[model samples]
Target: MISYLSASYIYPVTGPVLKNGVIGIDPDGLIRTVLSAEEAKNQNIELVTFYEGLLVPGFVNTHCHLELSHLKGKVEQHTGLTDFVQTVMKLRGADDSAIELAMLRADVEMLENGIVAVGDISNQAISSGIKRGSPIYYHTFLEVMGFNPATAKASINRALEFKQKFEGFPLSIVPHAPYSVSAELFEELRLVAEELPGPVSIHNQETPDENAFFERKEGGFLKLYEFLGLDIGFYEPSGKTSLQTVLPMMSDRQKTLLVHNTMSSNADVVFAKALHPLLYWCLCPNANLYIENKLPDVDMLRATGVKITLGTDSLASNTGLSIFAEMLCLQDNFDIPVEELIQWATANGAEFLGISDRYGSFETGKRPGINLLDFEEVNGRIVLGREMRRLY
Candidate 1:
């Protein structure tokens, strides 16, 4: 049976917004068509009017670390990324039961916030069970890391074993970050991607210290290696930015998502686009503020005309797992339009995670999971009032 849902405005994402729109959906939730209220009335169609909010497609969280949900308030805010990483490593192994429960709660919270799909990062198989029974679609990135070149092969073997535990799920063995991954490990990931194709997400330029270490071989990362009791004897500075040095090691054949990018420059962005045409820039603004008290130069990112997506990172680095909250943070700081933010949170993310066919827009035959972005009209300007409500 066909049903009609009417709203004041419907953002199709793929097409123009329909004013006083009526969306026709089948019993199974597939969108049949979208028509204006007048068009529906002319056809003598019944409509179920939702008196408030703008109807939109469910959000896609393009980057997340589901396993780190237990570390919500464990680490203090405004700590640098190096200290944050050290604290996580020290405190993340407290209790298995607690970690599992936290992951479960985060999954439910995202579903409640109208997150229809996720591109989650995992260093281990701890989140496998949660994703197995999760209502939200997840594309797991089996993240592997090793700063030492000698251990790169061993690290890939261990990652392969971890990936085996997550069989029957959409998984990709990917590098963790430029600071944590050696050149050999990146080549290993590229070779694995040749066998099983998928997009790769890496923590990129989260701090200026990362680029500093790559440029002149002197920075906080030197102290970080000392703190971890690791030797950097074989390591050599490339005299370039961290992203510029490491991106060459990545596969141009596969699509890549550069997460964070808190310190990425215009030259780096241009180099990335030239290196990999299928590159995507992911912004986790809240997480950037939490760790470094700063945000990426979003204006520069926008100026590049690069496809941008939004991510919540993890509870450890953010207050919550809501894409709407992330967007609000950007809006408050950057003054971006709400419509453009919606596209970043929804359509661009879906395309990156390879779930666009069913999740991006409310096109015909797509079950995009209708969402209501509730807002209050304040002095002729629309202000988002509350958390997003899932309508389907």
Candidate 2:
């Protein structure tokens, strides 16, 4: 049986908005076709489930840390990246039962928020069971971080072991962040990524200190290293931003997703675009404001013609895992068009994770779960309401 759903507006993500659009879906949730009300009327289609709001493809969260869900509200907000990292290190450990429960709740939350797919980061295999059983699609990133050059091989080996635990799931080995990975480890991970099947993700330029540390070896990261009791005697200043310093170590053959460009300049974006053929920039606006009390230069990034996606970092640094909320944040701050924001929240993320064929847009044969947004228009702008729900 085919179910027909119609709404005030339909955003397919890859195409123009359809007013009073009707979407035909198979019983298995695969999209069969999209047509206008006039087209449907011409075809003698009588039965339709009509909705009063906008309909869009379900959200794809490009970056998240499902393992850190237990840390929600435990850390203070607006503490800056260095202090935020220190706090997370101290409060991240908990009992197995507690961690599992938190992961389960976070998964449910994301689903209820109309998220159909996620690119989650995992340092351990603890969340494997939950992800395996989840209705929402998940691509786990086995995150490894080691600042000591001598332990580079050990770190990648450990990451590989964790990857084994997620055998049937879509996953890849990736670096945690620039501040926590050594040059040797970056090279080792690059080699692994070259052979890997998915895009690699890294936390990039989340703070000015990240650039300062690489350029002059002076910044809050210096204190971060001291707090971890790691010596960097052999490391030298690269005299460039962290993104510039690390982009060369990565493989241009493989796609790379750089998360949190809070301090990334226009030059950094240009350099990254020129050097890497396949590059994606992920924005976590709520988490950025929570940790650093700032947001990225959205105009600079957009102007550079870089592919941009959205993420809900983690419950540790955010109040909730809602892509709708992230979109509103960007809209409120940057006044980005709703159509463009929808692309970042849906198609762009699915493209980055290599799942565009199955998800992303509302194209025929794709099962990009349906989402309804009960929004209001004010002064020629979309004022998103809080009543977003999954309709599929």
Candidate 3:
């Protein structure tokens, strides 16, 4: 019932690396002790070893949308966020089976790619890995959007019903975005957050249009709201609130992760870091590029000291569900070190999701939910091995 991981490098967050490490795991999958190869030889266990591989904790993707897994390459760059949203709405209806299949498939992809857990945005009542086999922890953040004042309370009530239905799963209720959620609706959702759990997330500043619309009701989102048969003025929040508006509304337990913060003010990021020492700032780089063709200021986020986590958005907008690839993008464009980037996606992200006790590090008695980082062995580079289940 126990398993041992023989790794070249055991990167525990607390101390120096355990080189030529051997982690002895208990029958329940928690580690017993991380020791040297010599220590491992004296222990009684089943050993899993590779010639050249480093073992680290399973990666945690703080934000994603598994329901839109079917839309990976269907949308193009010229199509911004709103356009992608509309396209999914239209296409999701045309093929229900495909959407379900896509969701399950993406769940598997995440496991294969080494993602141990995710903070997913869920719509329609379908559960990712709920009915299927997925070895990943999911915190499904149910998305709520009701622009009509008449339906604000009713909308929240309905969401509460859904939360009850999925009470068996780890789930939560949250606003979709600043633009899409009305002030009254945000209040209702905030109330829900207070009663529910910690760590809520909302799409804060994904596009310039959303900013314009929130401030002046004067942008592409405003036009879309009108075209979609919704009124902008009816949901009037502060005419010009940004992070300033959301921070106060969010639970002081942790400012909800501000996603796609392409336009977060310096003051906002600073305030967030001050409010929560381990505040998570989630980045959906591909989603930003797919809709607006711009990325959030990565350098600014790194400088602000906000812990960063990666999300693949939906399969509809990305090439694959790979945090490794996401890290590659960060390094390609932002100059972040591989080790630090790995921590953001792995350790820090797990801390934000409130599952660090079970999944974040290669501690002596922790689950090292591992994913194959690289396929080939090469010199002057790290080589990760096959996907392995939690040792329990």
Candidate 4:
């Protein structure tokens, strides 16, 4: 049996918006069809009215740190990424029960906000059980970072062991970032890519100091190392942007998701795209502001026509885990269109995570969860209101 849901606007995502649109879904939540209200009426389909909003596909969060859900409100805001990393390193460990409870709460929050899938970052096997039981589809990236060449082999071995611990889930081993990973570690990542190809997500160019550290081996990152007591005497400057150096090492066989990109320029996008055709750029606007108090050059990124996706980072660097909040932040700050933002929040992210077949857009045979984006009229244009509801 098919049931119909009608809304003020229906963004099928893969197609044009239908004014007073109706979507038909089967009992299993798979979309059966999307038609205009007049068409549905003419066809004698029974429709349920979802008053005053746009019905969209469920959000796909392309980047997150579920293991760090326990650190919400514990890490200070606007500390910059270097200091933020150090702070997380020091304080991420708490009582096991507290961490588990926090993970459960964060999971519930994302579900309430209509998140259907996540590309989560994991350093250890802590959240594997939670992810297995989650209603949300998860693709875990076992994050590995070793700035020292001597420890690269050990890091790869340990990351592989961690990957084995998540034997039943969708996952891949990936680098944490360009700055924290060494040349040898990147080679290890490449080997892993050759052996097990999947989507990869990594932190990128969130600060000027990251580029400085790569190009000249001098920046606040030096201070970060000093703070951590890391001996970087064997490291060499790449004399190029951090992305320019690391992106080339990635496997062209795998898709890569570059997160944050707060400092990525046109040249960086062009260079990275030329190296890997399957690259997707992910933006975490709220988390960027929470840590660095700056946003990516979104206009520059838009002009390049690179596929972009949205993420909520983690509760550690954000107040909550709503992609709606992430969207509002973009709309409030940038000149991007709501249509493009929705694409980033949905289809593009699902593609990056390799779940687009069933999660990105409202196509027949896909159970892309439906969400209602409640809106209000402002200056004669529809804009997102504070109220959001999950319809299916």
Candidate 5:
């Protein structure tokens, strides 16, 4: 049996930090045993040290838009959410070959960043190249958008057909966003989600604009609709809004994932958590900042015992797809522990996608789809110091 030992901090999610820890991985990728360095040394185990870098599990990004990969720096000039929406829609029907290349490149970028999995959102039209064995494992959330009941049926049918193309374990049909989808369309997706066996993801409360549009038919989105010649009569502002209205409509078997709730308050988070503590919140900090220019109230969300995870939206709204960059953005704001942050991007991400049984943790019998990082030095000297360089 091949056993690998490492002296790095182990983040198993439910215990004290095992300082100077040694984790053994047998021939099977599953973790054979996790022991202290001294204990492993006493047993004559061969050790490969990762210096001071924590040997945490690979990151799990819970949301991203791979199809928008080609528009890396194209939409930045747009002023508000509505304007940005127009810009994306304008490019809606692009050449198939060009779009495919950017999508493939974006996929490769995420894999290189130590991301073993993702919760990706798609219009389902681009359902050709994305599959299980491609770069990183993905839970494809087929998105649909329509303003009237007439278009709703067609939208839902297309989404369902697209989702069926994936004859794999990690995939599902889900809404695109709360605002873009009309209540009629949302209800249709709800019925589809009800029959789905897996979890569902939605862009809820992503911005104050989305909340305003849904709750009052006012905000940047209203202006965008007026400019685009889309009618806004079906809009009925529910003075009260949250996933509560939407969740109950979906299948009980499927867990709901609320993405980009940057506008959700402490009370909003508390109520949602109490309703379903298992519900997950996907924070696209970089994407939020890039478009609407704000991140979520992470402290409030975490305090509510809600599950929170990170995502690198896509090249459209982000410079690149890197879980490390996303986690660093979190550190730039929240005073969270390194291990917990690691869990948010790794185990928690995998669990949300319902693929935790395989790739999340580094244990025996699991696929070692593990990724190692290579640090870039500024001047032939490590910034963190040579003693604290390599990390598993």
Candidate 6:
């Protein structure tokens, strides 16, 4: 049997909004068709369930760390990136049961927030079990981090073995970040990424120090390296922004997602677009504010016409894991269009994860979960309320 659902507005993301749109869905949640209220009435469809707010495709979170959920509230806020990293390194350990329970809770929290799909970062196999049994779709990015050039091969080998733990799930091996990975490790990861079916992700220039370290071999990160007792004496400054230094090492054919681009300038965006054909910029606004107390130059990124997506980062750096909250944060700060923000939270993220075929928008034969947005008009503009729920 097919059930019909109608809402105040239907945002297909890739298409124009439909007023009082009725979407027909099968019991398995596959979309059968979408029609206007007039069309449904003309067809003599009498059981249409109507709602008072917008209907949108479920959200897609392009970057998250389910493994770090147990660390919520353990780290201080607005400590800057280097200090935040040091705190996380010290507090990332916990009992296995505590970690598992936290992952389960975080998964349910994402589902409750109307998130249907996620691209999560995994450093170990602990999250594999939770993901295997989850109803929400997940694409795991097995992250590899090594700053020593001599450990590059060993790091990739370890990641290869770790990939086996997620045998039945969609996954890819990727580098952690530019500052934590050596040039040799980046090259090795690029070769592995060439064989994978999904895109690569990395924490980009979250602070000025990230660029400073690459440009002149000086920054707060030098202290971080010293704190870890790693010898970087052989490393040389690239005299360029971190993004520029690393973009050339990545394959132009590979799709890459640069996260937390808080310090990325317009020149960095231009250079990356020119060098890489497939690229995505992931914004985790709340986490940026939580750590660095600053937001990205979002206007510059929008003007560059780059493909943008949304992420919640991790519980370590955020109070909650809701893409709706992320959207509201952006809207409050930038006053961007609600429709554009919806695209970033849904379709654009699915595209980056290569799951657009199944989860991005409301198209026939797709099971993109249904979501409702309660909103109130403010000064003739639609301002989304905090009450978002999954309807299907």
TM-scores for every predicted model: 0.97, 0.98, 0.87, 0.97, 0.88, 0.98
Tens digits of per-residue lDDT for model 1, 1-392: 88889887888999887878889999888999888778888888874756477899999999999999999988899999999998998888968899999999999999988899999999999999999999899999999989989989999999999988889998889999999999888888888988879888999999989999999988789988998888999999999999999999988877789999999999999998888888999999999999999999999999999999999999999889999899888878886766788899899999998888999898998988888887767677666666678887
lDDT of 2 at 325: 94
lDDT of 5 by residue, 171-202 (tens): 67777766666677877776765577688888
Could you tell which candidate, 2 or 4, scores higher by lDDT? 2
List clashing residue pairs in candidate 6.
Answer: none
Residues forming the 10-long window of minimal summed lDDT in candidate 4 = 44-53
lDDT of 3 by residue, 122-162 (tens): 76576644533567888888888877767789888878777
Candidate 1, position 142, lDDT = 92
lDDT of each: 0.90, 0.92, 0.71, 0.90, 0.70, 0.92
Give per-residue CA lDDT, model 6, range 82-110, as digits (tens).
99999998999999999999999999999
Tens-place lDDT digits, model 4, residues 1-392: 88888888888899988878888898889899888878888888764756688899999998989989999999999999889989998999899889889999999999999999999999999899899899999999999998888889999999998988899899999999998888899998888887779989889999999999999998899999888789999888989999999888888778889999999989999998788898999999999999999999999999999999999999889999999899999989886666788899999998888888999898888999999997776776667777788877
Candidate 5 TM-score, C-alpha based? 0.88
Identify the runs in model 1 with alpha carbons over 4 angstroms from their true place.
376-383
TM-score: which is higher, 1 or 3? 1
Record all residue pairs in model 1 with backbone atoms less than 3 Å apart, i.e. clashing. none
Q: Indicate the TM-score of model 3.
A: 0.87
The count of backbone overlaps in candidate 3 is 10
Model 1 RMSD, rounded to 1 decimal: 1.4
Candidate 5 residue 4 C-alpha distance from true site, Å: 1.5
* Runs off by more than 4 Å, candidate 6: none
